[model samples]
Target: MSSISIAWIALPFFVGFVIYLLPKLDRYLALSTAFASVAFALWLFVVQSPINLQLIDHFGVTLILDPLAGYFILTNALVTAAVIIYCWHSGRTSFFYAQTIILHGSVNAAFSCSDFVSLYVALEVISIASFLLIAYPRTDRSIWVGLRYLFTSNIAMLFYLVGAVLVYQAHHSFSYVGLRGAPPEAIALIFLGLLVKGGIFVSGLWLPMTHSESEAPVSALLSGFVVKAGVFPLVRFALLLEEIDPIVRIFGVGTALLGVSYAVFEKDTKRLLAYSTVAQLGFIIGAPTVAGFYALTHGLVKAALFLTAGILPSRSFKELREKAIATPVWIALVVASLSISGFPLLAGFGAKVSTLENLMPWQVIPMNVAALGTAITYAKFVFLPRGGEAKVGTGFWAAIALLIGGLFIANIAYPEAYTIANIVKLLLTIALGWIAHLLIFQQAFVKLPRLLEGFEHLIGVMSLTLVVLFWMMMA
Candidate 1:
């Protein structure tokens, strides 16, 4: 691929600034930018890349668009398009569009990075852009949660920067390849930062609230694309550190279970999706190739779920039965929910089956349990409120249609996904999930959708996570 093609990374950034200058044309510009992005990502993926050729190279800075980065860019682009459409349809302004579009560029920048310094700067930009989007509602709660997210993200990135410095001091290079030569403490610190930033395990305690509190389109971007900034690089880094794989899987399994436990009891629909994002990320990180595809599956499906939530008049489980929803919204809700639950013929089934295949036989059982919990958690989506407006916004259908199309991605190539055994397993899981929900999960106890309610607690969790990560690496 030509180096000029790499300018695609900066497209959204420039368009986003133009969006700021021409607030009235935000919708048109943003839509063009989002689609053009998806096209470029696909174009890059289709073309052969020279592995040794840097997409961008300069004084102590470098970037590349290898297959791995291409995959992540595609995932981010697909979701950002959906989110951009949903935001415009939902009547968000140019200012909101500016932050989200800029955030999209930041994500692309992050995934393109080949050096720790570049990655750190990209992530910091991501934090600033996401913080703006998170606080868009300007409510006391939105502001507070946004600040919490910003505070945690900044601290995490700061730690990462220090680790990067140490890596350079020891290895005299900032490239990921140099990680193998760096001090163990440096790598541990970097991993800890990524885990927190990516919303994994104890370090990710801020995720549920931060994601749940943001507006739906904003939440979609956060869940679908932003968190990958932390984990996507880790997948590449694992190639350099063989020991990191087992460590990542242990945390992945824990995150999967713990995240679903919170989701099953969540009172708010948005909060449930937030926890599910955490759970799904936990699910996605188990195997490298599977992680990539599963992350793509999740990016599309979760964005649809959040956008579906946005369209519903109801905000909680109980409200679903009582409220009226547009027919399209109702349909989108079921599809997105079922997709996340790994229903047959959907995106989740293929990626998740691949994940299960790659897991240790013993590990498969808990992930299956996590899958079952996912079905149970999403079953509440079925209440299918009382009424419908035939005239939902064009943007809603446009966005939902695009996402639904993305759902079948690469599933056609997976023959195993269509096997009778998997089909039967899915049916039984959903059936059992319904029974469990009817018998017990009835918001049996209010969870505040609660946990990690304070910023101090967030700091505490980060510190504890850092300590454990350090101890593990040192040992």
Candidate 2:
């Protein structure tokens, strides 16, 4: 396909058009659109199409169908596709389908964009769509969350615009290629600006509330893909500039560990999962500074885990917790928990090892401790006993299938050749993590705090403050 021929690849455009034509078809809209979007995005990744261009002058509109963008798009589309299936079954209203499609397309555009202006437009579209999605059900809490998201995101956009202006002033063009000669302070500000979209652990107060309270599938897409939109730009910025300031390390790791710390006290299943997203993103952001390959691994597994969490908890969410105390659901939960904790060879472990291996030993220590903490917090999910079994729902089975497929795909899709050693290590990690959970943490699991009862806004406030302080200092 010619690169420009990708007008059809603008999956969201088609979705938006469909929504306008059939506004009442909310039920099937998200599912059907998601399927179409995923198929197109897959083609975008595989085909040798040139960079998709919409407009060009001194400042052009272009999409780089490169491996980097392909990686993010594939995961983003996969998550949306999985969550759309779950939503179809869960009976969520289709009124938000347009917003979901818009969000998906905007985020996908953000990933593939090759210039600052294009990337900004993509992020802005996603931000507006997310605000709508957050406020879709329009509860008082949803309204509040939506307002917070809208305000915080717009401010971030302003900062990004300022940085864009600075880059344009200095380089005479607004392109990723133009950022190379940009000064350190401008680069740092741009990075911080993008961090808002990424939902860095420190400044991401809007995530848990908006996502956890939104409809489940909305929560899934937001958690699984939208937050990741920020990371792509951050990575691009880091690559463009040569500066290796220590603040990047501090901000990234602090964000990851802080979120994980929040997860330790979080009781709400969805909220806890949201905090985990921050923690996982922390690793991805920090890893690239030290090693290159880890982000790829983390992106795949974390996206899968987020999608799985979003899919689970259809009705008896409350009862599901109670039943989990002594059922087979515990098995599924443990596998996911261990996978996220980097127990050894599971998806998380592969990401962690690949990420931290290249860092200095001392720098590696904090990450290791964070991984251990991740283990402890996730261990709380293992309330179901080893021997008990319960009936599985279609959603439950779907969640299981998604998780396995995610890992399998991650293992295969990685550019590096997979070795038996890696596979063996992953299996070993799963075994040990499970054994350790059963032997040492089983009692603690029973005693863990309830998800909703332990909620606090303190951590969110503190993290936001630190992020601001770091940005100011870097500026």
Candidate 3:
């Protein structure tokens, strides 16, 4: 990589200095810092090269430049930018902006890392930063949530550490290239570790509590990029384990379906979004078991949508479902809802179609359920009562741009597309989602179905147990 690559490394440092010196310039500081980081990452797309560093003579780390990493970096940059814009007017503490800069920089580092050691260190850096960001406002609920995240995250990292030790003992290297034919036990253990951080079922217990409570911008970053830090690594590990055990495929599907089921009824808008993350991840995690492209699209679109969803004001959720939002927030929520529900011609649709195309019809039950579940949750937003104040801004447009960009990518990759069957299936999903909402979730229903409200989270806990059981059996 050129010197520009270092810009990614330097982002957090630069933001740190600004925060330290001109604390009062908080607004401009966040805007400029977010833009700078995205700009640097965008520049990386043009000046791509491999940057290898000697952490040790025997164990150096390499940063690889490829489409996969670029896609993620780009998504992270766009979402962060949108989030910063969304938060620009919100009365947040300067500390939040400063921490976001730090988190973004660490995420850049993590995405660029090519070795296990670098990846692990980078992951840890983001984890600590994320926990603090959650607790920064220092409310009792936030503090308790952050502590829960801290404890669970440390335990997950410990699992990663143990897995790392075993891998190093067996392969004698921390580089991803070092683990080519490792034992099944090591791969399974490492995945078990990573699943926790990836927000996969079971070990992802802390996600809802913390994610739903954090400040909107922070929540966007956490769901959008932070949690995904574990995904590519999981995909890599899954590839490594393909030969050892095919059953991991089963785990992925089960987890994905379960996540959608619980996400169906999650009450808090942010938490509902958080549960969808698990379901979205579940869809992609099952990708390695089928098609590489499925996983690829899922990661890109999921990250973008998650971040965009988080940046909008809390009113976006409540007003849409409980009462009409201000015109601007309502429009933004509409776009977000469409993007997440995978509406025909949207980014989510492409990801869902691609993943489903990679699976058998019988295997698509969960995929259908997940799509329906997501659609239903978002539809609830559509029902928000008549009116509120309106103010649309750059953040809202940024989300629309991302949704369009994702659609463009999908179209380019799969032209002469949109099978009639696919169209019918999508329409059916939307109809079912709407009908389900009317029957069970409508305000007139006088009571929200707790099962639908908390479905994704319930599935998350269940998936976690299933993973542990699978691990035990394999062990």
Candidate 4:
């Protein structure tokens, strides 16, 4: 690895600080940062290796640009570019661009780190930047949700830190190899922390409110990249620790079902998409090998969906039905939503089929069920009218066009998805889901339990989940 590769992490941080000093240059700097990231992601694809990043004179950790991390960084780069491009044409402030660029840099850092201590540092940076990005709108609600995100995320990291301490005491290293001889309690704690951060099942109960209340572009970042921070590493570590794989997939299945159920019943447009983010996290988590590909496609589709939401007149379904949307935005929404729902001949179908083909037979059926639920969830928005011109700028279309293009580009992994058998199955899934949507959409909204709704409740759930993870690990 070139020592110059350190520039990958350092350059973004430097640009972010520069953005703070020269706020007037924020948009150009942010776009430049995105373009640079795209260039580096391309480089990592061609040449993969581990770089030892020395922070202090005597201290350093390894950061690898393995294919897994490369895939995620590429996805992160493209979505971040799309978002910055979208904001470039908007009336947004320099502060938003600066923070977003910082957030984008932090995620790239997190994706590249190979050791627990460095990963934790990167994750905390991501959390802080994410908190700032989501709350930038400064509404009372946005502020409240942002603080809630900070508090919960900090607690989760505390578990991760403690677990790292336990592992280091036993093995005296921060590398993933250090976890090789660590106790189950230690592993469980780390798993619990990552589970919450990864947006799995009860642990990720914070997702909907955080994503929905944020501005559209912010929501895109949250769903498309933020939650994947924990998931990418978790999947990597799971591949190392065989005992953790089934456990992660178990929770992954639960997350998919729980998220899609909420999405199917959701009335708010952004919130529904937020729920869909949670569901796709499940998909990515449930299949470790295909996760990079699945996450890439979903990330691209989600950016398109959330950005499309931003161009809309209202978030409420009733209001959206009454309003006429622009042709470009509407087409973007349909294509993105269908791709997300695993429609045949789309990026999502390929990813989904890859996931199913890789899963244990017993696990396949429930994942298919979740896939069906996904179709039903997106059905609510697929036919929204494409009549009015929304006065959006070319940058907006440019961003969406880039993401939609990436969707097809991502299909290189699963050409077998076009097989007649898989196509028929996916078609049937969508047809049934659409029928179910027709039946269910007319009913009043279903309310979920309030007992597990907030930060305090989530803390309790995390404890319970930790206990469960311990039992699973020890068994």
Candidates ranked by lDDT, best first? Answer: 4, 1, 3, 2
Quick one: best lDDT, which candidate? Answer: 4
TM per model?
Answer: 0.93, 0.80, 0.81, 0.95
What's the count of clashing pairs in each model shown?
1, 5, 15, 0
Candidate 2 weakest ten by summed lDDT: 446-455
Q: Which wins on lDDT, candidate 2 or candidate 4?
A: 4
TM-score of 4: 0.95
- Over 1-475, each residue of candidate 3 has an lDDT whose tens digit, in order, gives 4455665567665876688677788657766766675566556556566345544455676666545566566666666665666666667777777777777777777777777778888888888888888887889978877776776667667766776777788778877766566555555556665777777765565676567777666776777778778776766555655543244455567667766766665556667777777777777666654333444344444544454445444524444454445665555556557656766665556666776776645557766676788788778666655466645566556654654465455545554347888878877888888888888865332323434224355345534654664465356
lDDT values for all models: 0.81, 0.64, 0.64, 0.84
In candidate 3, clashing pairs total 15
Stretches > 4 Å off in candidate 4: 48-59, 442-444
TM-score of 1: 0.93
Candidate 4 lDDT over residue span 252-356, tens digit each: 888999898888878889988988988999999889987888988988999889988887889988777788787877888888888987887678889988888
Model 1 clash pairs? 447-450
RMSD (Cα, Å) for all candidates, in order, is 2.3, 4.8, 4.7, 2.0
Model 1 poorest 10 in a row by lDDT: 50-59
| Candidate 4 lDDT score at position 428 | 90
Q: Distance (Å) between predicted and true CA of 442, model 1?
A: 3.3
* Candidate 4 lowest-lDDT run of ten: 50-59
Badly placed stretches (over 4 Å) of model 1 are: 48-52, 55-59, 89-91, 383-391, 446-451
What C-alpha lDDT, on a 0 to 100 scale, does residue 68 get in candidate 1?
Answer: 67
